[model samples]
Target chain A: MATSTPTPDTPAGPTPTEARHRRIGELFWSSDPNELRPWEERFTLSATLLLLLLLLGSPATVPTTLLAVTGLVARDLLHRTWFWMAVAATFPLGLLRMSWLAWDNHHFLLLYWIVAIAITRLAAEPDEQLRRSARLLLGLTFLFATLWKLGTPDFRSGEFFAYLTVSDPRIANVLVALGLQDGTVVPTLAAELRQLEPGADAALPIAPGVWRVAELLAWATIAVEGAIAALYLAPLTSRWRWLRDAALVAFVLVTYPVAPVSGFGWLLVSMGLMATSLTGRRRTTLYLGAFLAIAVFTERNAVRNAIEQVLSLLPGVG
Target chain B: MGAIGRFTGLVAPLALVLVAVLQVWGVTQHDLSQWKGGGFGMFSTVDANANRVLDVRLVTEEGAFPLTPAELVGVAPQGTGRFVSGTLTLPTDDRLDRIAELAERSAWYLDEQGAATSDPSSASPQLEVQAVEVTVYRPVPDRADQRLRFEPIAHRRLESPA
Candidate 1:
């Protein structure tokens, strides 16, 4: 309950606006050990950490690398408007140079989030602006994703996941362990698919069992993504508001482990963290856990390995 | 909030709209993959890089020879991989021109095996590239067989400078 009123020593003391600015600056830049940091401050730190992780993980283009090193050296620079403007500006420049060749969809997500954070820093009510922006962006992301999946015939027919299971080694391992396809089928199918000439009338054989599992996965993905989108876009006063955090956290936990794109997962969690109520300790803890979970998932196939270990313990399974 | 702050607040939402519009435009007009350019279409479609291929060939006075991986690496040493990737993602006229320009500017020679080489010392016969042809192929599932086939979605050919 801090007041923005000027004190009796107003002649010598800073004006209310200056005082407020200093307080906001302290919220971001201060490193006092004893001072209790609020959730907003903590959110900013988490976002900065997420940005640093992105810059480090991405191709070491000059601008991104320089931004990463500078932010690391002077951590406080992350709080500055000019610094974020440079950051927000760097992404488009990178996109122009790299174009579609190298950038993933999540790179665009990262850019949007960075832009939101940059704009938030310039606002009088940064926390409010950030929350609104985060919710809107997250909602739009899933909406577009769901729409794309629905529009694409391949996705609806489960061809995408079926092909991915046989092709992508990471996904193939998981599916193979789940008994969707025998271990031998992956390499053989993949080889045949690779060797098949473009526009050739030849079709690769897919086991009926694998096709069913892929269809199930495709539908499940749609359901979950659609649910998350609906929940995030729901009105603030609606009963659905409380469930947004749970849905997002669950999405992160379930999606990142198998997919293993931790940068995208981390960015989602950061946005979820921003959108949630700061007053709830449990919500904050849940987000922090999600962050750590993404790190663990990215560092190694912890969840997949653990699943495999469990499957090995089961009878007639390995 | 001041006017600038208010305007700044709108930037994120406006950008979201702009991205969605551009992504759709790309998908419909340029045959840009759904999974790229801020569409959030990742994991939604198999139409990504894995399903796309770029076939580049250098048409010389004698015959058309496939541009070897080595030649591609040699031409744009710094950005060869990305250049190839960019062409596959969205094979616009500009990107094709750039690729053709790179090939035309660099000197190519044929070795004893008649394979093109960028090195002068390996030259058995000097070769002049007449044009560069780049075709972008994408996998499209055949309805009858349910098997994926590569179809040439876009093709670009640029004549070399005299």
Candidate 2:
């Protein structure tokens, strides 16, 4: 009895396929088959442009900026055919600026977008794929980083952070709080340091509580990184998935205040929020605000000033 | 997405993961330096039984000018690229070629760092660097403080025009 009647087996609402198609249709932009929201496109372009500009302009020697600019123009302002050109060029351009690329641990985050852009050109439904790749990259990065840190005895002993706190200018402000300066002698390592010629090497004594601080920090780093890894690996149906992401956002806010890896935090924030569909709009917006806020506060010059201000408040250290 | 397109999307992440895995494997074998590409071996050498530090300087008729290895490669100071060390000496094919290459690079880094006044118009005496010297220092390994001694395990010298 084919009477133009719906089957009893039919669901009351739209089928899964219909719902997915409707969603994709809503996000469709341009004549291309790829499905990325207009906002996602704009955000990706802005992030790439800003990241390249900051990298190239600040250092003064990165010639890759010109390549990146060409790629950006070709991809965004030109035909869809040129999108592949932009994507193809980013890798070599990145290689040409290998010095900057290898400068920091977090620089690998930039490659996430580079690969995502390339995937967008190849896929019909690009947003999900792009976001999936990003999430996977972030997870992989954290997992490997966690493993690397775990493998290092120095890191486990907190000595690595101690060395960084003592030597690296980026986190040197912590010294002021220790009631010492960059080159003060640590009592424990003082004798060996004294054996060397006076000016040949600068050795500093760890502040009384620096080791404990470093130890806690080391453990905290491992913990947070592991949690982030779990976030990406968690099943889509897991009830606790959102908690892990919130923890990551909080970790970024708290840790970046001290270490202040500006670009690193910024990239993480952007990538962390890319799973908007899975994470939901409100949480994504929250992370975006957190990212922008952290980015603004951690501007290189601003970070230096903030460090200087904190140091000046210390007694006799100013 | 077509099956081929879907397959390509999968390839991107898999490729990244593969590279990362290969990098990790290479690092465990100590065959890869982990400097050029995204590798997870950063700080892996912190616990090395022995650590080597390279100190390079350009010696001139006037005085010695301190410079970093990165400067030798025409890059601004990036600290050390890796923990690995190699002996560079005269008559060694690759080492000599490297020295010659660096000599051809502009030494304006000295002027940029304000180590010397190289103004052509100024009447002040110019710092004329005559040769480059590289010294490698290794930790005693069993030392209590991990102090690096002044004695160098390897040294290289290359004469330059200026």
Each model's DockQ score: 0.45, 0.22
Candidate 2 — which residues are off by over 4 angstroms? A1-81, A84-91, A97-107, A169-172, A178-202, A236-238, A276-281, A300-318, B25-36, B41-52, B56-97, B100-162
Please, what are the lDDT tens digits per residue for candidate 2 over residues B64-142?
7665545554442233232123321111234434553454344433454455332344445455667766555433221
lDDT of 1 by residue, A1-318 (tens): 243345686545567776665566555435431243455555555665566666745543688668867876676676678987887777677666665546787777777888888888888877667778888888888888998888888888888887777667778787677766667766786677656544453454566777778788889989889988888777767455768888889989888777868778888887887787644346556877888888787867566788789999999996
Top candidate, metric lDDT: 1
For model 2, residues A67-121, the per-residue Cα lDDT tens digits are 4565454444322535544544544465445443233445554654555656555
Candidate 2 pairs with clashing backbones: A185-A205, A186-A205, B129-B162
